[model samples]
Target: MQKRAFTLIELLVVIAIIAILAAILFPVFAQAREKARQTSCLSNQKQIGLGVMQYVQDYDETYPTAYYYKNNTATVNGGSAGGYVHMSVLINPYLKNAQVWVCPSDALRGVGPDNPACADWTNITQIGCEAQVPRLSYIPNSSIMPRKRGPQDAPNVVSMAAVDAPADVIAIGEMTDFSNCIFLGSTGQQNNERRNKSHRPVNAIMRTAGGGQWAGQSVADVTGPIFAITQAAAQGAEGWGGPADTRAITNTAGCRGSAADGGLHIRFMSPGRHSGGSNYMFADGHAKWHRFNDTINPNRFLWGRTYFPSGQPVLDQAGVQVR
Candidate 1:
């Protein structure tokens, strides 16, 4: 038999076919991987919702405070500051697994300037992660939980019974580098980050304290808003159509206009950009995924009982990676 070799054009054609197949399959594979991560995140949220519900049952149906100081009256930077505690810590007993607080797709890992990876949880004890106090992948609804720093302000709590539509109200949502636990107040004074897109809680104040010191005193004593409050994205009462929100979301934030901070502004960044939407835990402890814009749909707004728009979403303002 005579030896034969494949023609160059034939080989090229085969290679081209392989390349085309790869191009088509790669995105599908990527989406599959992303779907897996989102599923894992949703599982975490489901457990979290159950844990919160169990916690509520034990605590007389009152939602846990996002955070509270052992010494609320402690002066800022005062040495006598009492170590603070977060909602995650309060519900750990119900969860039985500290890692449940983390989402598999968490890109920023945890809040704070340290930028610890998701695997690097706090170890000083009583904190959420191996290295941080409130390191978490989920954010509680501030409207129900209330955003209280170390101050004399009375605890503004919403009980399970107080919610008119428990199923429709959001109990918890995924956290992103740009997410504020306070929900979508992405306009004017409604902005949690009067500055830009950043974790409203993990600000300068959190940078001032260590994980151990935090376990011993309220973070507010040394910080401004270490307790992150939810979306605080570009939505308001009109359900994403709010005038200020429309201005913020319709255009690529910074490209169309300028924010007070002088950075690229984007009114809304999808919290669940992993899958076009993010996972949420409802007040009833049921968890599921939802589209970001859909969460604020005029006919079906789910952030809370009402909406308010404020803040300009500064894309560059977020100090960490969300993807």
Candidate 2:
């Protein structure tokens, strides 16, 4: 038999077939990987839910505060100085693992100006006293636990028993860099940043001896209106529509938008961080993957009874009917 070499046409055909197979299979592989991440995220939330329940059982059924001043009466305006204690710090003991503070899909883990990645959460013994707290991939429900202050000028701590429905109350969700925000007023405020876009840097007030010290402009806080409250209390209610396609997603460092200093803002808006939707945990120790488009009934699933009481019409940022 004479040795023969393959013709150029045969090689080209083989290459074309391989390329077509790769094009078809690569997406499937990517989707599979993403699905795994989503599943992991859901499991993390479920564990967090269990931790929360355990915390409630041990602590008289009160949900942990998001972050609070050492002194509750130390108003930011009054120049009262006090450190902040984040919810992660409080919940970590229950979780006993620093890994749960981050989501697998979060790109900004341990990222900041000084740190290349998020700081190791293992040694974070104190929260409010530290200049920067351990960055987390999840955010607490500001409706049940307000960022700056609780409802009616109360502290940002709620009794778990107070919620109308524990199963419907959103405990925590996957948060991105842009998700760490608080609403100050409407879009028309004097210095308020436009909604649904990158918000203006907020002037953070660090803890100082006599009062709150101006820490300079912080990219962590975004001020707007309180949508988590009922329609009657939906002050500055409106949808902040972003013009750009990527505007809805969080920044790479996980610190994309603005953050509140002294936790001075109202509601914590959904970051739309995850693809299609986001993963959230309910107060009743159950986790659910909520699609953004499918969230027509904003009653208990979105925030809770405190924010969306029964019979309230679910509206978008523009005050249009969502359902």
Q: Pick the TM-score winner.
A: 2
List lDDT for all candidates, in order. 0.48, 0.47
lDDT of 1 by residue, 1-323 (tens): 99999999999999999999999999999999989988887888888888889999999988876655443445432111233446776777777686776677775564441222124332223222223334566666654565444554433455777765778867777654443321333342222343222222211111211211111123243233221112333332211212221223443332223233321112223244456677888888999887665664434556553211111111112322111
Best by lDDT: 1
Superposed Cα RMSD, model 1? 11.7
TM-score of each predicted structure versus truth: 0.62, 0.64
User: Which ten contiguous residues of candidate 1 have the minimum total lDDT?
Assistant: 307-316
Q: Least lDDT summed over 10 consecutive residues: which range in candidate 2?
A: 197-206
After superposing candidate 1 on the true structure, give the runs of residues whose Cα lies further than 4 Å from its correct spot: 73-81, 112-134, 178-270, 306-323
Clash totals for all candidate models: 30, 23
